[model samples]
Target chain A: MRRVVITGAGTINALGRDVATTLEAMREGRCGISDLKMRDLERLAIRIGGQVHDYVPEDRWNRQQIALYDRFTQFALIAAEEAIQQSGLSFTGKLAARSGVVLGTAGGGLSTSDENYRTVYEEGKNRVHPFIVPKLMNNAAASHVSMEHNLKGPTFTVATACASSNHAMGQAFHMIRSGMSDVMLTGGSEAMLCFGGLKAWEGLRVMSKDACRPFSLNRNGMVQGEGAAMFVFEDYDHAKARGAEILAEVIGFAMTSDAADIVMPSKQGAARAIQGAMTDAQLNSDDVGYINAHGTGTAANDKTECAAVADVFGHHADDLMISSTKSMHGHLIGGTGAVELLACIMALRDGVIAPTIGYEEPDPECALDVVPNEARDAKVDVVLSNAFAFGGLNAVLALRKFA
Target chain B: MTVRDKVIAIIAEQAVLEPSDVTGDSSLEDLGIDSMGLVESIFAIEEAFDISVPFNANDPSESDFDISSVDAIVAAVEKLKAEQA
Candidate 1:
């Protein structure tokens, strides 16, 4: 099997607009959850979120590009620009044909959908925008990335709720391992922090009213976040031959469905994915030193995730450092796993474990060694990133430090 | 109808069984009602009784809603409806 490696990564989340600033924020335990700045705030029950601040699309894109690209797609393109530039890959000839883009997004073009819907219904407008369909489609980000990079190979989108990015990246890793594509422009983007997005989630009542406190005793629910994280995943041999810098090696990936409930998470299903990822990576439970948890801070997800990890790792669960970056970045939903993967990279590459911020009192149910409230320096060779979606879809990825 | 009868009827409707077939101690798992059916059963009970159930599917033990048997569910729902009234 061809080994898959990460060549470059870029992100624009609540933490920072670029990789360097974001990683630095993680190292320092910066909390990005703030009062959401959008119209119709009175209508929303949960108004706080981790929104990307001070993003001026006009600085990077023209007026025409701005009109064509929604907030989510603009984020994808911006992150992709940094990632591809860092990768230094110019697609032409066979390389162009062998490379493609696969992105994950739970709510693609949500801002576009919200704007057009408000225009039609609330404002008494007869007709919506002309490009509404093209702009609001779920595959808009993947399509735009393919067009911009001239990736003629297989291109598609994955929309498996919160696990979208992990499922998409898992598929991309499979393609590279199976010799389908030499490189994949993979990761995800989401802009679900708009009015309609918050309104819909408010109905579910899983949103935190105050702050995101994962694995904490008084935690109410999850806080919604918006942004994108894009990565360049290349074949390891291909990356080494070109002398490109390797970020981290993608060792293994696994996905499992709970087949239990739509909203409730299943412990058995999550455990299966975690154990499966370790088996696929050929790493024992003791070999893993850290984990980026899918700790959404909701009453259901945090405890259930802890139970799953304990079941899978057994005694080693106590030794390994586990943290939920969602406590800092708020839950990014589909784009979350990709951003959480950045934490795993930071753990293995820089010997830093990002802490679960906003943690005050720990719950007895979630008694794992949660690196609470502060970042820690730890030399970990292997790390696992977990993403469990709303529909009980679980995707776990195992990464190793490139020796 | 009594709360027992109504709850049994809802569970039976989900399991494709008659109220007579659903015993007080019959488990939903035995009736072949999957997790989705269980959720739907809870929703129907909530709507019918106009009371919220403290059911957490992640850890059922942590919730107030009991799932050991039909009798347990009926008792919990009755208790909730009484408290609401």
Candidate 2:
């Protein structure tokens, strides 16, 4: 089996518009969440989010392209351009035929749907935009990425709620490892901070109005975020042959279903995924130095994730530095794992562990070293990014420092 | 129907029990009402009474709206109605 390595990484999140700015924010423990400025903000109980400010589409795209692209698709395209450019590989001939795009998005073109629903139902309009269906489809981002890059291989989108990005990235990794593809463009994007989206989430009552205080005793719930992060996963041999800059090696990936509850997370299921990833990578528990936790700040998720870590790592769980960047960037739902993976890369590559900001009082249930409120510099050989969705789907990816 | 009766009716529907089987002192747990059920019940109460309840499903105990028992939920709904009025 061929080994996989990430040659390029790019992102546009609440913390920053590109990879460098985002890592800098993570290093500084800066909080990007603020009072959300969107249409019909008064109707939402959860008023704050990690919204990307001043993201005007006209500045980036032409009118015809804007007509075809939704906000999520636009974010994906922007990130993909940065990632593909950084990879320094043009998709043509055999490369173009073997390369693919796999993206994850839970609420694709939700803003478009929300507006059109208001137009027809609320305003009693008889017609809608002609490109509504194409723009709102879940695979729109993946399709657009493939088309722009001229990738003709296996291309699709994965939607497993919050675990979407991890699942999509994991599949991309396998596709390369199994010799189905030599390179894959993989990541996720979400732009769900609209009136209808927030309204639906508000019904569940799992959103924090003030802040996302992950693993804190005073933590209320998760805060929604919006953005995209994309990466180029290439075969190690392929990257080495081209002398491409290696970001990190995709060593292992594992996904599991709780089959227990739709909303509540299961510790055993999460533990299994963690253990499975380590086992797949042939890495011992002691080898992992940092973990990007799926800490949504909800009362259910943090405790359950901590318990799973404890169960999987045992005594090493105490020594392992785990942090949730979600507290800084907020929860992007489907797009979250892709953004959080940047923290893991930072840990393995730069030896900087992203801090879980907004951490106030520590919860007894989550007593592990969360690297709270301050970034830590430590040489780490391996790291894991964990994503557990609302549907009891858990995906974990293991990465190793490139030698 | 009275506020208590309406609250009991909503709880019964969530628990899939008869209104006659529900009592003021009965806890939601005793009636097999899960977290999702509680959220639906809260929404039903909000729509029925036309008052917003300050509740967070992540930590029900931390929420200002009491949900300890049928009587507590009814009392909390009454307080919200009075405050909103």
Residue A225 error, candidate 2, Å: 0.3
Candidate 1 lDDT over A1-403, as tens digits, reads 9999999898999999988888999989999999999898987767899998778889988977777899999989888888999999988889989999999999999899899988888898999757888888888888899899888899999999999999999999999999999999999899999998998886564677788889998777899888889899999989999999999999999999999888889999999999999999999999999999999988888899999999998998999989999988889899999998899999989999999999999799999988999999999999999999988999999999998
Query: In model 1, how many backbone clashes occur?
Result: 0
Q: What shift in Å separates residue A129 of candidate 2 from its native position after superposition? A: 1.3
Tell me the spans in candidate 1 whose CA falls farther than 4 Å from its real position. Answer: B1-85
RMSD (Cα, Å) for all candidates, in order, is 4.5, 0.7
Best by lDDT: 2
Candidate 2 per-residue C-alpha lDDT over B1-85 given as tens digits, one digit per residue, 9 for 90 to 100: 9899999999999999999999999899999999999999999999999999999988899889989999999899899889998
Q: lDDT of model 1 at residue A294? A: 94
- Tens-digit per-residue lDDT, B15-54, candidate 1: 9998999999888999999766876788788888888776
Candidate models: Cα lDDT each:
0.90, 0.95
TM-score of each: 0.85, 0.99
Ten-residue region with minimum lDDT total, candidate 1 chain B: B54-63
Report the TM-score of candidate 2, chain B only.
Answer: 0.97
